[model samples]
Target chain A: MNGLLIAIKSETFIALRTFASKLIVAAPALVAAAQLLLVRLTEAGQQARDSLLGGSNFEADVANNAYGFFVDSLSTGLTMLGLLLVAQAAYSYSYERDIGSIRHILIRRVSRRSLLSAKLIHLHVLALLSVLLLLVSSYLLSGMLWEYSAIVEDGFELISESEIREEITLGIQLALLPLPAAIAFGLLISVSAQSATQAVSTALGITLAIDIFKGLLGGSGPLSLCEFPAFPDRPVLFTIRQSHSARLFRCIDR
Target chain B: MQALSVTGLNKKYGSFAVLDDLNLQIDKGSIHGLVGLNGSGKTTTIECILGLQEFNSGSITALGYPPPQLHLSKGRLVAIFDSPSLHPNLTVRQCLEHALLLCEKPKRSTEDVETLLGISRFRDFKIKNLSLGNKRRASIAQALLGDPEFIVLDEPFNGLDAEGVDDVLELIRTLNRDQGTTFLLCSHQLPYLEQICSHIAILHKGKISHSDTINNLLGNTQTILQLKTAETEAASKVLETISGAELIDIDTDGYLNIRISGADSIAINQAMVENKIPVAELILKRASLAGLFREITSEDA
Candidate 1:
């Protein structure tokens, strides 16, 4: 137990002084913010074109809700974050081994198992911070670009604001479920690899392979569960967007 | 008490053996040098001893702890590898502070070790930006944060200049004298080892060919005298009458190579003068660790 604490302290000491950990924590938020900005600019151009033609559509306004864009930004950010986490986790161990730094910690006071556990914990902490930053930045940027409101068509309320929030919350929870598994998988590849370059390349390669083949597997097994949260075409993001549209269509039919 | 012990150790890679029934024991407060050829498994032995790799068959103990459990010693055992095993991106000061995290009871501050290693000016420099010698200095500085009872160094003097080597030798002497620290140094630099190490172990043919005090090992080796004389026949006859002198060979350079056990150079010169043999040149080659190592390693070749 004492050895484990010392290992964690050493890991934290290095992470605080290094740039890779900071990249892992901040890169996702920056990319997500850039994505939100691009989408807002495109939407404003479409609005200006519509106004010039004097053709104002109610459905267009409904489709431009903040919730949808927020979900989209989350998807983009999570996709990048997923890859970054895997690459970072894979690089962490093998890079240290390549430089032969791990031998000192192993011979000094920390055991092999303790050092591995500390790395796992450190990666998870970085993931958590990244997710929090992603959530806050996406939420703020989406709200700034568009108004958060219910789906209303011809003065008839289709979905309430609380219902939209609950559905989006559920979508985000489902998207975040597979991240820990991704980190663990990367670390597994790290320890087995012969060099840092091989570890990072192999881990990213295997992850991409799984992501590409997930649809062919019918999305039924455990492997697909790990792939759902990280890819851009994930079902949870689309479900939230489609559920809003489906509700408005059902009310129109009634 | 023995600081480290390896008994009947056997390690093999597939079908080839690297260490076969190798045994070595290092007493506390003594500096032991492990000398071997390029492919003699010096690094492999250090790795197995530190639990960095697994051995096929062996029973090794360092500071009363097995290789896997060496961590239980709580910063009592440390090793400086051939390559400076440090984070390349971290500054020298940051590396020392990071090493302090592993020291249960740090005996020296970051400033202390940096100054001791003469790397105070390079404290803020990144390890990758420093020269190989300064990188090694930073590596050694980190290892000295704690008062380690047993320290293992592999190729400790690979990159250092003359001054750096002298500083390290002085540090080792002070630690072994004041703190009673035990060191196991594995290096190819035989002359440096002879100057710093109190005991020597020669690893040859997958086993220790010689292991003893520096005096015992070098004292047992006979000195060689290269005698060049105008009257070679007369010199050979006079050398045969000497009690401890034996003529080994006459080289192509017309110099008589004589192996002397208990005879002095002056006595041989006097005998040559009494026999009317004028000596042109005479050279005395004293026994050294390098010479002894060459003799032991070349026996099978």
Candidate 2:
């Protein structure tokens, strides 16, 4: 409908001009890059110490794999991204309502439903951009610091490169599968809340509370907390499953 | 044709009634003022009309669309609220540009509206940094970008200075005159309403207690003529003899107040002169919107 398009244009206009949207897009990548840098620095120091002692170990070999570091960086970045997106989603609508700016669009060119749909679409676009940037920065930094190869132990292959790539693909799919639900929940909270501050605090509080509660209940099979190691096999799988329940919970919310 | 019509409107919050069987109609191309007390459901009525909230029961048609479908009008309807409805982080120009995205068919450029609102200099000012008055001017300027057929303004004069008020009033008058734009202004500013509104509706006790043309509504109330005379007794006697003239009060300052209906100053002065009552100072206080509003509200209270 024409009204829906106008609403989307209005949403896009504000998102392009405001700093909040940019913050959401760039902050995750920046944090992930810093994390990769810190890890690489620490690993280099440990390697220097090992050479001084005239010794090396298996832990060093496993830690030197770019895939593991890449997955770790993604885990940290995605966890932060999830929280940031929820908070931003909560803040977006309620803040506009607090300032009374949303009323004009409602009265002039669009219905409430269209305005909501436009916000949902806008936030998703921001999420996608943020994720893309996070992926590039984390992938590049991890590759620079560590070698991209199969996990090898004494000439016998523990894990092949093809297997690692497939697992990473599956990990990313699983982690991202629940994001739409998370964003929807944030919007629901935003609309339900009385103020921007209330909406942000409540949404984040609920997310953290669920994370803690899930961790305490002894999550079934793989690691469940995206923030914590949920799976023992792959760093990639742990991060993927950590976000799974929340995404599932988000669908229920939707 | 009517620009707005509400019939059998009933709205309640829990057990308390806000609008009870309310009905109102606004003729097209007329500037109507909606005046009411605090918590008297003025803004509530507006929210219902704009479809921002669901009414308990009623039918509201604004510009021929139901409240829920007002958006189908596509920029033909606009509303400016008491608070400046703008993104605090955006500069005035950016905000106007953002608003332009919603205007399906814009009639004026951003610069023209900024100039009209006297906010050209503040075009680069962020909404958060601008003074309340400037912010309001910018808000008004955004509304002017589209040639809206119907505009609803709630407390439009809240943050305006005297000069700003004059500019807005002039702007409203011009738009109504030139473009035949219909306006529903809800404000506590009675004097400005009197100056600009063609019609007035007084909401009281959850209903439209009074609604009519400015002249017709004010005309129903009595006009007080205060005269300080040399012969107070003769002046009282002269007024008693005149039809539709009742001596209401005599102040300690030796001024006599008479409430007269269906009589002009000429007739009152002629009667006094014929009786040889010496009139030194005379002030005719015609019924005003403020006075009538006060009278009606106080009576209801």
Candidate 3:
């Protein structure tokens, strides 16, 4: 048990540090900052319409309208996370090859299974942490903006606390669920790839294919590979002022 | 006891046969030096023994466990390769720590390894930042972590300076002596291998051409002799005492160059002294591996 934990810790630490060490926590933070900008935009739109377009209901339109930008930012951040997985895994394997580290590892008492497992698990943890940080930041910044607008005057329907929390939680969960698939895909590519460029380009190419297939598959159905659609229906990550928001929040809470 | 036994191992990469009918037996507690020319399949053999390469046919038993049942020999068989195979993005400390964590046995504290390898200065430095020699040392340190029963090192001295070589050689000696460690060292450097390895296996064209105790193998092989004698007639007479000795035609300069297998300098010296032949100078030269390799391969061709 101790050895396993140590292995897990070492694997995770190396993976996280490798990704974080480069450019130093800037990319994910930048993504979060962009989402915050969207929040600010939504807040400004709400403020301008409070007097003319009615108070609470107008705020709902503002938040609902900003959903597209939020989804875009989150998707971009996820894409970056995917890039991180592909790059780190590819670099990890290729650099090990160059340095003869693979020989060293193979000659050790460790099983090939453990080595491969540690790598996949490590990469997943790193990707998860980056996603979590981005999601947390985006939610907090956007929530703060929504709260600030609530201070001036009551809109048609102010977002309740529980509703905000549920949306944030669900949004994060939704973003995180696809990550395992991405990591598994990345690992499959990394193992077979001889070079980092080959690994990254291949992984990106596959992601693009999935995106294209997802676009071609149209419907409220899950993004199955075969159901090719033209455009995706965006999920509203957060809601604003609506007259029945409290009741809706209560129903969702139940 | 045999530390490793490989028989009829065959491997092919696409159409190229990397290892064919390769057979070797390394005795426990002996340093077995594996020698070959470039593309002679030394690395491939090591990789096969280490269970890193999939063999097409044949069997390998290392430290009493068959491979690719390599997990059974986990922590018992370890190897280091020519390329200092380590994660470059990892600090020397991180590499060690991770390697330790991965080993079957609990890893010893890093302090001992750090001190032994004199890598304290670069413990915090990433592998890419360390010089080649330091990386090699770190690799050795990592290989030694599990107190393995057998170690296979491929061209470990390739990038080391004299001091680094001495340091590594000393460490290898200590490990073998203190722990009863068996080593299969692959190298093109014969002189260096002669110093450390008790047994030698010579590979040519993906086959084991010769394998024997280093001394016996060297003893039976012929050596080139470059001699300058004061009296060519007396030297020839003295040399006649040694059987199987041949005189290559001398140049305009009366240099008595002979190829001899059956005799050493002492025998010739005794014969000269006994026969009242005045001996001005006698030189016995050791043949390098390249000479032996060429002789073996060209004869095959």
On TM-score, the leading prediction is 1
Residue A153 of candidate 1: its Cα lDDT? 72
List residue ranges in candidate 1 displaced over 4 A: A219-223, A226-229, A232-236, A239-254
Candidate 2: misplaced stretches above 4 Å?
A219-254
| Each prediction's whole-model lDDT (CA) | 0.88, 0.84, 0.68
Candidate 1, B1-301: lDDT as tens digits: 9999999888898899999999999999999999999889888888989998889997999999999999999889999999999999999999999999999899999999999999999999999999999999999999999999999999999899999999999999999999999999999999999999999999997898899999999999999999999789889999999999999999999999999998989999999988888999999999999999999989899
lDDT of 3 by residue, B15-52 (tens): 99988888998899999999887888888888888787
Candidate 1 per-residue lDDT over residues A53-130, each given as its tens digit? 887666677667887777777878888888888898899999999999999999988999999999999998999999
Better of 1 and 3 by lDDT: 1
Error of 2 at A17 (Å): 1.1
CAPRI-style grade of the A/B interface in model 2? medium
Expressed as tens digits, the lDDT of each residue in B119-149 for candidate 2 is 9998899999999999999999999999899
Give the Cα-based TM-score of candidate 1 against the true structure. Answer: 0.96
User: Which 10 consecutive residues of model 2 chain A have the lowest summed lDDT?
Assistant: A245-254
- A best-first ranking of the candidates according to their DockQ comes to 1, 2, 3
DockQ in order:
0.89, 0.73, 0.47
TM-score for predicted model 2 compared with the true structure:
0.93
DockQ of 2: 0.73
